[model samples]
Target: MLPQRVRLQYEASVLHPDSLIGCGVRRIPEGSTERYTRWINTITQDQLTTQVYTSHGPTVVMPTWFCSRNWFQRVGPFDEGGKGVPEDLLFFYQSLRRGGGVARVDHCLLVYRYHEKAATHSVLEETIWNLRVDFLQERVLSQWESFTIWNAGKQGRKLYRCLSPANQRKVKAFCDVDENKIQKGFYTYEESKERPKPKIPVLHYKEASSPFIICVKLDMTGGVLEENLNSLQLREGADYFHFN
Candidate 1:
């Protein structure tokens, strides 16, 4: 029972009648039955870790998630808020909010479903966005007094506008490799309540100072980004973070 609970919780696959099966687990689809479900006595962490990444473990497994029954009582039960609440996602975020690590074991124990209208689809896109933004602001932005926004493009400016006012004032510069935005020299804060629009200087990526919050999306721009960042001699973590 311990082996079953620990092994298949993350990876869910049907087991065949010809193979070994656990008590109370039945009605597995024919041909869907996994060939390897023969009675299991013990399972190793490596096998488990592989399964974890294979299916639901990617969704809920934490590398260091082990608590006694008493601990569970202290941690409380599932948030049974039902559909549209994204109870699982909310719980994961709260775990992180309480200083939990994002982790996963390498195992395949659970038989996960590939459903069309799962609970995940019920959560609104806007809800996810707001949650991500709030988490990002809480986990990262609060630490820095100021940071330059990379790109100076539409997305970058949009992020600047979306930032809380205090964070907005911390935007020291707008930077880009594009000659057009760079040639313009500055981006005016047309929406600010100040008497005059705040003119934030735009600099070529090479010229712009570091400690940047990059709005640049990866795997796009034909590797021009790598070249630009390399030219600046700026190390990634020390000099910037991706907000894209």
Candidate 2:
């Protein structure tokens, strides 16, 4: 971060809890002497339009977060949690803590270079799963007294397995279109801590009740799931929400 070589730099752009980064870049042409001058020229005319998600966090040009040095002196720096830890999420969390708004610029202001070996690829699918499960429970499941699971298939069962025990008890029933699962009458949770394994009833979508946490993915259903929801005359966000 040499001052002369740098284009725009911030100290700690994180808003204490909100890590909003002010972005700019030095378009140095293959290590040319005029690099800083070129960066200055590039900086003069380009103010990228950014949108913020207040509930979420700020997103600038993928690579160019532009906050001033003095401003960063107050806001702070990014958390560099290496390896599998999600650094972007960590920053977003900190940003929200600092009361910085989440936003993004619609226009492509910076060049995002792609390569075969990016650090982001180090994260596994299961890590994302655990995070999503935790978030869903916090933001949604905690609000409900009870709810129905939309499918009785493998995916639905997988979601059931991932739920917290207290949340698991709140599952009223499993709703499905498959005749075999419905005819099975109930699903046995063989892995439960209770003395007797929990046997959850299976019901037809119309016969079962809401509010449903639909585990079915939209496009994969080939419109069948959509049709079924529509047939029941249920509303989204209120009656049910898509978890998949």
Candidate 3:
């Protein structure tokens, strides 16, 4: 359990009753889930919403969450489905849909333990991927007429295949730094029943247009990917949203 002062700090930091308040966390055994831990502790305040579509599950780790009872009742009773259900993520998404906000206390208030037997491991990656795609389509993709995907690699192609037929039609290109993928020119949707397979152009990142659904994972590229993106000078939530 957190010390009294930490609890007080969290309570004091609440911006409003409607906010899903979380705090930074330190993982047990030091390096477990290193990238995920860094993401939870370091994302900017605005990224609490903007980065919601990423594979990280939730921008704020669920164990650190606190909220008013009134707000909780409004946004959730949580999914009662047993073991495999991602109740926290489901609740988080519902809260966002109901005009709730997210805020972090910016202090390490929890020691998040990682174990192979944890209930979280019961939840399948594909389950979360499908949920994320649905929410992204509902909240962000519906607003764009066309967009570029920031990777021409596995993750990017998976996102394209996962999108609904209507949203898939909105994909103008897949942009990448890989010369081979760029030289290949286009990605064909071989799964589609349409007589002419849908082909999406694969361009160098500099040649692609925004708004973009970036499928590239941040921090993993040793800043090369970030450098490429920053060069574009595009607004994050508006010009792009990270879906990795």
Best by TM-score: 3
Q: What's each prediction's TM-score?
A: 0.61, 0.61, 0.96
- For this target, which candidate reaches the highest lDDT against the unseen true structure? 3
lDDT agreement with native, every candidate: 0.56, 0.61, 0.90
Residue 134 error for model 3, in Å? 0.3
Judge candidate 3 against the unseen true structure and give its global Cα lDDT, from 0 to 1.
0.90
In TM-score terms, candidate 2 sits at 0.61
Local accuracy of candidate 2 as per-residue lDDT tens digits, 114-165: 4447676686667656765675676568889999999999978888889999
What are the per-model C-alpha RMSD values against the true structure? 10.7, 10.5, 1.3
Clash-forming residue pairs, model 3: none
Question: Regarding TM-score, does 2 or 3 come out ahead?
Answer: 3
In candidate 2, how many Å is residue 151 off? 1.7
Tens digits of per-residue lDDT for model 3, 115-199: 9999999999999999999999999999999999999999999999999999999999999999999999999999999879999
Residues 1-244, candidate 1, lDDT per residue (tens digit)? 2255544422321222111112222113432323223211122322232221111212343322443344234445657977766565565556445443332233343443334566777877666656655655676677887778898988789778877888788888999978999999999989899878788999987777878877786436777886777877876546665555
